[model samples]
Target: MRAVRLSVVTAAATAAALAAVTGCTEKSDASGGDDRVVKVTATDSKCEVSKTKFPAGHIQIDVENKGSKVTEVYLLFPDDRIVTERENIGPGTKQKVTAEVKEGDYRIACKPGMKGKGIRQDVTATGSGKVAKRDPRLDAAVASYREYAQEQADETLPKAKVFAQAVKDGDIEAAKKAYADSRIGWERTEPVAESFGDIDPKVDLREDGLEEGQDLEKDWTGWHRLERSLWQDKKLTDRDSELADQLITDLTDWQKRVGKAEITPTSMANGAKELLDEVATGKVTGEEERYSHTDLVDFKANVEGAEKSYELLKPVASENDAALTKELDTQFAALNTLLDKYREDKTSYVFTSYDKVGKADRKELSDAVNALAEPLSKLAAAVVK
Candidate 1:
């Protein structure tokens, strides 16, 4: 587990819950008896989604973790592609999320302890699968985000290859330098990458993200695995070289598939919040770039991606909730200003290693992240309203 240096809002509180599609959902009872709202009761072994069938548009999931561990909920396509998800739901916490789903077979999966494939319940959406008519600006926002995701994928492959080549050549110093650079594009468009269901685990999964009983030599083969070789292990292996090739292969698949991802204004809004959650859980905690201490680099990219989403949705969100937009603007500026102070080179993205950062400073960063996150949680609702 990553070290938690300060109190920060969990992903459930800061990012999860509200997601996808058009229209607001009517409130429902928390028990597994709600008719309109899809009430989900998650225990260690069971994931109970109240109604198996519902109307096609405006799908809402009201999740309560009656389990002993932190859990996650997902709306998955029949092929297991993630439509949208809410992660890090602590025991006894309740989350309400809404997503746009077309008429299709789907699964509501809940992962207790936030690990493994999760207990899944079959679900389907009935009736005309058409989504509610979205505003023109929201449509434009989806289009723009799709383009941005593609661009990030298009750029990531080459940079990743650079890191891969350095590893293949067994050049430790070069590999170290290229590692953080390659990850920037991935961090920027993480949500789009994650929508694929399979790619992120293959290309970016950290060692700790592995399921229980998974062998490191066999199961752990991604950026973090390679990262250990360059930094902590202080050595390279023939397997590391093979992993470098596999990383490129996985990324190539991601680049090819990005255009097919489902992008909605609400998804973008939810994704922006997810980015901030990454900062709080991984980057701010110094667990993401643990050996490299390049958390700040990833931190910056996450914020930039979140800001881009917010900016794209601002036109519509401001109209729906001007106060939220204004508060978000102030918070974003505050966070950015705080981050800038850590940068030794304002001209470049590099910053001081996180290990050098004091505990109080970390607390300050965590607070800034939480301050922005509270408003970010309302982003999906604002855009859809």
Candidate 2:
């Protein structure tokens, strides 16, 4: 697999200059003097040209953001001089930038959102000019995505180990509290739950917590019982030794799962889509409001999922079916852009008054997320086909 690089959108001044020079064509009365126009569209970290050929002299770049995020487009010269930069073209929107060129070989680099991969194309300055195929944004996005995942994984493991040790050391009360707190990390990683499926059933305490002949609550609340046991000094008796051993076994299994698992792009995309759907349906309930941490955790999970999806899909973009690839590219870009706003809004909550963020704020967030559904659905449909 090709190594992915972290994507940080470089300033216009930092990009390469156009190198290839071409002869000017005689102006014809029928068409406007040899001015060439190129339309560059970015979707799912890939760039495509509506037309391959145009006249060279003054060039106009029309950028269409068909993806789910904002994107940056750059026209570069051979000398690494940036001809022009068009930044923050929002989802489903379009923007134009013009540059005068003597013509030669120039590169067009488009990055979908600040953190996304970049798409690059090499164009030749000919009689007019022709758009060539190149994709650097995809590489950038994938690289950034992998980098983000690795960081999260690194942070999560040591914390999990600390909590696990607390449990083994008979610091039951501390272990219970840590377990509850740890849910924030685990829930963000629900898609990877299978990796931790070996959680020791003995530690679950679900069966022992039940009252004689009583029915279990629909919600998974066994953690609460474990909490009580820790504080109440209700140590397992000799007869319960078998269950304790089983619990230890389960925890060990969970550790292995966490160590070996790799998160896939498809899973991240699908999971985010589902969570967003729930939010749209208002199924998230008051728990989301009361437990602000839940919202924060969910937001992080969604971001991670979006990042991973871009990473996985970007590398395969060129090989995908044309229409499908184009559609996915567009959606991925839009989603990445939208996530930036979502992250900002979420961060502001730390200082902003939550009570003031009422219905309008929630609606705005929902609308931003809903904007992602169409493109994502199209991408999903294409994958199945």
> By TM-score, who's the top model here?
1
The reply for model 2, stretches above 4 Å from the true place, is 1-154, 160-188, 192-252, 258-269, 282-293, 318-356, 381-385
Worst 10 residues of 1 by lDDT: 4-13
**Per-residue lDDT of 124 in model 1:** 81
lDDT of 2 by residue, 1-385 (tens): 0001112212222212222111112221112432466778887668897554555554656778899977767665544344445555678987655444444677787877633336878786556543333245443543454455445555555565555556556665566546534433433444333222223112332333233344443212223333434544455333223333333444454444453443333334443444455444432232332322234434445545653554455445335546655665565566445445544464432222233446776665567556654345333222222
Model 1 residue 324 lDDT score: 93
Model 2 quality (TM-score): 0.39
- In order, what is each prediction's RMSD in angstroms? 5.8, 18.5
Q: What number of clashing residue pairs does each candidate have, in the order they appear?
A: 1, 37
